[model samples]
Target: MKLQVAIDRVSLGYAVNLAEKLDSYVDIVEFGTSIVKDYGLIEIGHHRPAFKHAELLLDLKTFDEGPYEFEKGFDAQADILTVMGAAGADTLAGVHKVAQNRGGDLFIDLMETGTDKIAQISGFTDAIYGIHHSHDAVAGFDAVATVADFHEQFPNVKRISVAGGIDLPTAERLAKQGIAESVIVGSKIIKTADPVAAAKKFMEVIK
Candidate 1:
C-alpha cells in the first residue's frame, strides 16, 4: 500500500516547506487541483522537493484541453497527471499519450463518472483509475466501500487508487482490505499543525 499526501489550498511557500518535511514519509506527494489552479504549474512545479524517496502526483484534474495541460504539467516535472473520467474518450487518450511520451503516468479520476463510463475507460492498462469522492459534497464519503464496489463493478481494472476525506484509521482499513494501489489523503494531513508528522502517521497506517 502506498500513501499519497495532498497539499491543497495553502500558500506556495508553506506547501513547499511542508512537502520537503513530509518527503521521506509518504510514497507520493500530491499537489491537489486547487493548488495547481491557484498557483499555476510553474510555481507548483519549481517548488517540488528533491524527493529521492517519493513520486510527485499532480492532480491537474484536466477536464478539457488535455494536451496543453499535460504539457504544462510535464514541463513542470509532474511524475503523474490526472484527467477527469467524465472527459471524452479521445481526451483521455490524448492525456494518456502525453503521459506515455513524457514517461509520466496518467491517472483517470473517476470522480463523477458513472459505471458505464468506468467500464469504457477501464481498458487503459497503464493508467490509474482513481475512485474519488467530491470535496464539495455535503454528505460523508465511505471511500473503502465505494472502492470495493467499484472493483466489483470493474474487475478488469488493476491499477486502482482512492481519495477523498481519508484519515489514518481509514487508510489502515483500506490497506487491509487490499484493493487500492494507493490511497490519497488531503486536509487531514495538509491542514494539521505539523503536516510532516501527519504525513508520517498516515504512512504508518498504509505501511
Candidate 2:
C-alpha cells in the first residue's frame, strides 16, 4: 500500500514546506480542500511548488462543472484530483475524461454517497475509488471493517484508497488487509510535533 500524507488547515507556505519535507517519505502529498479554497488554484498554479518524488493530489470535491475544475486543477500541476461520488454520472464522466486525456488521475471520494450511486459510478476502471469517512461526522469509523464491506459490495472496483483519521496501526492493518491501493492520513502525521518522524513511523509500519 502507498502512503499519502495530507497537509491541511495550515497556511499555503506551511503546506508547501510540509509537502517538500515529506516528499521522499510518502508516495503522495495532498493539499486538502481547505488549502485550495483558501489559496485558490490560480495562485497555487502560478506559484507551483514542484515535488521531485511524491505525486500531488488536490481535494477539489468537485460537485459540478467537472471538466472546467479538472482542467484548472491539472493546470495547477496536480497529478491526482478528487471528484465527489455524489455527482451525476455525466459530471463524473466529464472529469474522468479530463484526467485521462491530461495524463492525470481521478480519485472518486465516496463520502456520504449511497450504495446505489456507488453501483452506478463503479465502472471508472482507471480512477481511484476512495473509501472515505467524513471528518465532521460524529460517528466512529472502522477502517478495516469498512474496507472489507466495500470490497464485498464492489468487488470489481480495483483501485481503492481510504482516508479519515488514519493512524500507524490502522495503516499497518490496511497494508496487511491488501485491499486499498493507498491510505490517506492527516492529523496523525501532520499534527504531530515532528511530522517527518510520525510519517516515517507510519511508513515503517505499513511496509
Query: Considering every candidate listed, which one attains the maximal TM-score?
Result: 2
lDDT of 2 by residue, 52-136 (tens): 8899999999999999999999999999999999999999999999999999999999998999999999999999999999999
Number of residue pairs clashing in candidate 2, backbone atoms closer than 3 angstroms, sequence gap of 3 or more or interchain: 0
Report, for every candidate in turn, its global Cα lDDT versus the true structure: 0.88, 0.95
* lDDT of model 1 at position 107: 92
lDDT of 1 by residue, 1-207 (tens): 988888888887877777777787888888878888898899777777678778888888998999999999998888999999999988998999999999999999998899889888899998899988899888899888888888888888989999889988899999999999999988898888888888888877787
Top of the candidates by lDDT: 2
Q: Which stretches of candidate 2 lie over 4 Å from their true place?
A: none
Error of 2 at 29 (Å): 0.3
Clashing pairs in 2: none
